[model samples]
Target: MTTTTETATHPLEILFQLQDLLLIARKKSEQKDRIPEHLQHVDAAFREISARRAERQERLKAAEARKKALEGEIADVAEKTKKYQGQLPSVKTNREYGALLNEIDGVKREVRAREDEILALEEQIATLKAEQAEVDATFPEEEARFEEQMAGWREEQAILAVDAERAAKRAAELRAGVDKKMLANFDRIAKARGGIAVVKVMMMASHTAACAGCNLRLRPQLLSDVRLSKEMVHCEGCRRILYWDHRADL
Candidate 1:
């Protein structure tokens, strides 16, 4: 009778090798998470400045419209004053001439008020233009800074890409050496638990154990199987595959 010898490799050794690859992959993912955070302030500032520029543009248009209206009112007042002066000579009585002169005075006052309004509108328009100029000068500098930051992010991403490729290749080699079902289960658990599927549990004593991932106490039976390395053992608390490191217990 012919019999085959079963493989004697320990599951913990396989997981230890897998953890090294996972740490590299996790580092790349975490570095990617920081890219957007670094640019958040610049992005928010751009949006706020853009809104201020739009509001100023609208105010400028309103000021120009007010100036034009004031000019039209002044012109109308001038025509009315001219007509009142022509009527002055035609007045028949002293009272009539006095009333005509008072009317002309009122028209002159109206003309002055309109001209003052036009001057105020012109000042407002100038201030708005200056603010717009300031924004225009400042926005480009921020834009250039944003571009520089983006370039730095791209450089880091390029480096991460190479590291990720190496990690993935190592992970593949490790996966092939592990039991197919264990790998599948590990992959599933990692997907559900954010890239952490296997964990080392410290046996506090022969009967007491603590899961490293969740810090939950491990059941005696579960700890025993993990120590024996006889079969796969999963933590009841975190549901992560558990392995005991003898050095940690020592």
Candidate 2:
């Protein structure tokens, strides 16, 4: 009772299935060959190291400022001591001479304290300089490594771009050969089915056949249509375009 329209072969159906396979392959290959996430970690590490270097430089500047301030204090104390010593020869009373000598001793004590502080700041500056040099030496190597990884990623992306373009062109050519109504139906199914618009029926060892897209059992009538391989058919359960896999024996 089946008319010719129901039994006629649809070549575009096979082309649709081939296009879907190509799309899946292209997507998977692009995903796998893309750059790994470690490149971002490298960039973060560089930023952290650069920040630490700036912090050390600021600390060194503060130390230098403290050292300079202490030097000025020491100079002022020395000048005060000299002035007090020169005034002691013109003093007529013992009280004035005693007070000037006391002032000179106090200034000398301050000068000694200031010199001790200067020495401490100098030691801190030296330590900071050594740490900065070590960081500087390591930074260049890290930056170079990141640059190399970025270059590799760019190259890989370029290759994937070419492959994707060729695949798209081939799919377009295949689509152009298909009837507009069939192509529209395929696209609608694909949009609803996560890029798996068509699938070949797969037979299991248990002698049960299933829709490869949804793994549902095929009905007796649907199975007959699939076995005939004359007309394009869809799985009633999953609504996916169905094709026979003669190479399933392989």
Candidate 3:
């Protein structure tokens, strides 16, 4: 069996709870908003690292191809030198022998040139391989770290979502218990006052009173109504709902 005093107190309690819920919701929504930006930065970091790794891999491939081609050229030059050397013993005349000898010298020069080209290519391959190895080794660790951080953030978001859901449910239950007219008034004032629909009056020196929401003087009648705490009251200056602060009396 609820009395008028108890029923009237319900509205204030519900309004307070509603304000709490809204505050918590606002904080959770802000955290949710930050998550997308954080995720974007993480994705960008991964993309940049992946691009660098791909570029390194392409360079390594090119270097390896050059090395293979140089190896083939060296092999071809070696074969030609072998063929020229085998012909040197079969030469029957000095002119033929001299011609063969000159041919051998030309083949040797070609081999030497091929060997130099192969050495340069090998050096390039070594540098490229080193760079590729470094990227490959470092990238996995970086990616793992980023993934771990993202997982933690996701977990936090999940927990916050659960908390927000519970808060929303409690707000809804409390709202249903409140009177329709009072709830509507609260909503209107909250909308007009940027979510500050309710405020407690603060007593001042010299028998004066001020609206806690806007720090404006209240009319004598307004003060009386707030003291009664029977119905909802509003501040004329800020239009915020007002209640008596019993703690101020002590």
Backbone clashes in each candidate structure, one number apiece?
Answer: 0, 0, 0
Task: Quote the positional error of residue 225 for candidate 1 in Å.
Answer: 1.6
* Regions of candidate 3 where Cα sits further than 4 Å from its true position: 1-10, 36-40, 43-145, 246-250
Error of 1 at 142 (Å): 7.9
Better of 1 and 2 by lDDT: 1
Better of 1 and 3 by lDDT: 1
| Tens digits of lDDT, candidate 3, 42-139 | 87888898988888788878877876887788788789889989888888999999998898889788878877877887888788788878888788
Q: Give the residue spans of candidate 1 off by over 4 A.
A: 1-9, 36-38, 43-145, 205-207, 247-250
As for candidate 2, its clashing pairs are none
**Candidate 1 lDDT:** 0.81
- Candidate whose TM-score is highest: 3
> What is model 1's C-alpha RMSD?
9.9
Model 1 Cα lDDT, one tens digit per residue, 38-136: 677876777787788889999999999888888888888889999999998899999999999999999999988888888888888999999899988
lDDT of every model, 2 decimals: 0.81, 0.78, 0.80
Better of 1 and 3 by TM-score: 3
Sort by lDDT, best first: what order? 1, 3, 2
Residue 210 shift from truth in candidate 2, angstroms? 1.1
Task: Report model 3's TM-score to 2 decimal places.
Answer: 0.53
